[model samples]
Target: MTSVNDQTQIEQETGNTEGESKDSVKQEKEMKPEESNANSPTELSKLTKIVKHSKPEQPLGFDGFKKQYYRYASKFGTTLNLLVVGGSSLGKTTFVNSLIQGSLTGKKTAKTSDFMQHRLRMTDGDINFNLTILDTPGFGEKCDNSNCWKPLANILVQRLNAYFENEIKACRQLPIVDTRIHGCLFFINPTGHMLDPLELYVMKRIDRFVNIIPVIAKADMLTPEECARFKRNIIKDLQHEHIQFFHEPGKSIEGINYGMPEPFALIGATKGMQSDSKNAIRGREYPWGVINIDDPQHSDFCAFRNFLLYTHAEALIEKTHKVIYDALRTERLNKLKSQPNGFYTSSKKLVEEYMKAELGRVERSLRQTVQDKLQEKENLLAYTEKQLEAKHKEYEESLINRCNELKSQKQSLENLVRSDKTKKHSIFFK
Candidate 1:
């Protein structure tokens, strides 16, 4: 009885504990609505602040990456890499200085026979983006232009390899620095002729790796008729050679169309022209009049500048990533995979072995299939033969039984006629 009473006390204590827990849960449920209602105004205020362009105390969406990039760019700025390839005295540096509106290079710059890098730190409106220039000097000046493009090619491949290396790594604490060039401004000399050997070689060498925009330098030196004829010849040559350039074939940028789809024939603006107007502009002052660089009748300088800086600036960088870098990445990966489709042969010996093994396996599978078919046919034939024999035996037994029954009937007739003593033997025989 004492034990029973103790069990009853234990049950009562557990029931009371469960009841207390349920009561506590109900209280929490009732208070949760009030708590949420009290904080609802704060949430609404946070949302209103976000709408007014102020950051919310809590993140409400996934613009974090964009914000991070904006912060990073505002702090350290971004880079736009460009390469300029042309002959000497083509006003490459002069054109750049005029474009930048300041002296990024020296006045009396020494003639460099090698590749040179120039940088300009300037604000493009509100954005602070640095411009990097790779200028190739002594291009056609050298007597032997045989391997002049090798240095440029090597540099391009080196940058691509660096990027690919950083991409394929398992883990990286820091982001990869994009040193790949965005575009190559190929300056073609206005000699009223087709593309030259050095120009073709250089353009073709780095065309697959980088974006190139051909510029016809010194358009003021050529007559209007000569320039038109020159552009036609260049177009014919480019089509004949099957060379791919930066933009789509037969397509021009909207509102930024230069003189032609390729080779914007524009005169490089002479920096600091002393014109009649009080304000100084980048142009040439002649005895007759001053020719403005931005004048469409004079050159396509303004249009080209608008396209390069304002219109297609981001497109240039994106093509470097999506088209050129993606192509490189695919090629590298395919070479590593060793595909046997004849496009790329990464490991010749391994591909051969793999194909040989596949062929052997396929042959064995076909052989097994033929064997299985033959075995199934043989089984059906044996079954048919057995059925045919059984049918023959059954027919033979029925015929024999019929013959025996006929003989027995004949004997019965003979016995009946012999017992009758009046039956004739001839009748029985008949």
Candidate 2:
């Protein structure tokens, strides 16, 4: 049933298609790589680029550096220094103990005002942290709490001074142990009212140098509603007073309370009371039931703790280094700018310059004093010589006058003798 002509046409068509495909393939093979590039702008841009699809042999990722840093940190643990200041009987000690359990031994105190520093090693998440807790006793406890902020301010200045000391060394220490106060937890008494004058003054005074975390201590004493009201009142008071706390700077906008609890209401757990629950959480024992410090309904302890350690630990440190520490550093540098060559000099270098200048001044002063004394002695001697010459001249003149007078007297006597001889005065002639 097949026609020979149709079959021949089909064969010719198939042959022609094969030849065309072969020709196109040959043309593609013959064309140079650049010649085959598209004429469209997008295609031309991509094809005309001299780069290759594969990345070169250069190492790009920071993973190696990151790992090295991590290893270094693990070897020598990271440090976090926290200063806790509050009035007496405000659970300062208890809260510190609970913050890093079993880290302290036998209340090692600083030289100032019952100020205790408990240094210990602890781990938070992956970081092996050397945590230092600075506690202040007898602060704001007196009837006249006006000058209470001084002691607190002194401690902060000491820490900053300490860092400055290490920083200015000729051969700087390999790892400058950063003992600067990273954060200050000011334990406000939970009166369910606004902050008092002393509290506000103390906070405002040191808040410039360190991060001040306004905490409502003994929050367990206040009811939920009362605690909430107190937090609000404290915020309003701080806002009204125009006080800056740690939380203020981290906030994206003004008058906004961010993720962290502002004026954190905290209830420190006492060992005397253990919860009757299966978990046996630490809390205060009440007549009716037990109050768990971890319970959010009870206090802001858990939230505060998490915020302190995990959530915003870096933020606190960052603010300290970037804002607080930088401000202090700039201030100190500005002060030092008054010194000779202090603008370009390190603190130690400035001190050395000052000492050299002082010594030079003393030497110059000594030389000048010695020169003055020598000049004075020379002038005195010259004056004495001149006076002696004038005295000698006067004596010579008097001697000549005396001689002349004597001669005149002798002559007169001679004439008198002659007259006496002439007048028969024998005794006068002898």
Candidate 3:
């Protein structure tokens, strides 16, 4: 019996020991998961990983960008006016069509024997452009092109005069739609020689009033060597004649090689065909391979395009306003001042009208200035009056408080005197 009792005791001890070992193993296993979590990357690191892998929201596409630009332009009231001036059959019409990116078949600038202006409005992407192509027909075509440039000169002067007249008028439209020629693109025939007399004459006459950009028309007619020589000659001639092309002062002239030589060699092609490389080139087909109009090696059309539309559009407009138009206005005013009073009766009346308008403008300005000063003074006086009123109220309140304190002191003094008398009487009675 003793041996059996000892065996039961041993079995209970072993079972308890085994259960403790098992519990310790299970605890270690649970703790292992927590240890692993602690060893892993931090929460911030995991968030960074997610951010690096996730796709960001895309930006607005071309159409959306154009609409946004248009909205801003409309709100600000801005427009580009381009005037294309070139002789007939010099790809002027073709160039205009290309600029507007239209397929108006057989729609050319009015090709009259005389100089004429054709008006067309075009909108590309977000930009709205008012295009005026001044076609000078029979310019160099005549045998005696002596005074051929006079018509164009007259047109520019007429525009200036009209603008001046509008300025002198009492009532005028708001944000006046400026019709003055901002830019003139003069086309030179690709003769691989210097500029013709007619081009030089026209350029000299209009360069002061407008920004002239010389173009070597039909550049593909000349070879590369010939084109280079032609460009050099044109530059030399322009420098000798003291003619100025479109160039902005105080602006960097870097990275514009093809345009710096002055007359940009250009080619305009309205037709195109697919080549073996599956590229549609707008060029004339020869026995050899194709010559792309946009290819820089072939022509400077791309360079000229960038210069016209991107680099100098705003500068041209600014120059016209500040330099050309302002100078013209000053000259007109000076002329009006110099004219005799009695002679040229119509001229005298016009000058008188202009002077009257000027006087009215000055009077209105002076009146406005006086009114503004008076308003400022009134505001200052009102502020001072308010301050004075507030100070007066404070002073009155302080005076009333002091008066009350004095009255209280007087009553207290009277009471004290009566108490002293009472004390004295009590002492006497005692």
User: Each prediction's Cα lDDT score?
Assistant: 0.69, 0.72, 0.67
Candidate 1 — which residues are off by over 4 angstroms?
Answer: 1-78, 104-109, 124-126, 249-260, 285-288, 337-430
Q: Lowest lDDT 10-mer window, candidate 2?
A: 47-56
Note the residue pairs that clash in candidate 2: none
lDDT (tens digit, per residue) of candidate 2 on 21-131: 432222212334567557655444334222111222443344477788888878887777899988777888778876766423324322235778999888755669787
Ranking by TM-score: 2, 1, 3
Candidate 1 lDDT for residue 106: 29
Q: List the pairs of residues colliding in candidate 1.
A: none
As for candidate 3, its clashing pairs are: none
Candidate 3 per-residue C-alpha lDDT over 10-121 given as tens digits, one digit per residue, 9 for 90 to 100: 4354332233333322221223333445544542222221111111143224347667866876555444556666665888766765555545343444455654566665
Query: Where is the poorest 10-residue window by lDDT in model 1?
Result: 46-55
- On TM-score, the candidate that comes out on top is 2
Better of 1 and 2 by TM-score: 2
Could you tell me the lDDT of residue 254 within candidate 3? 75
Residue 248 lDDT in candidate 1:
49
TM-score of each: 0.57, 0.61, 0.57
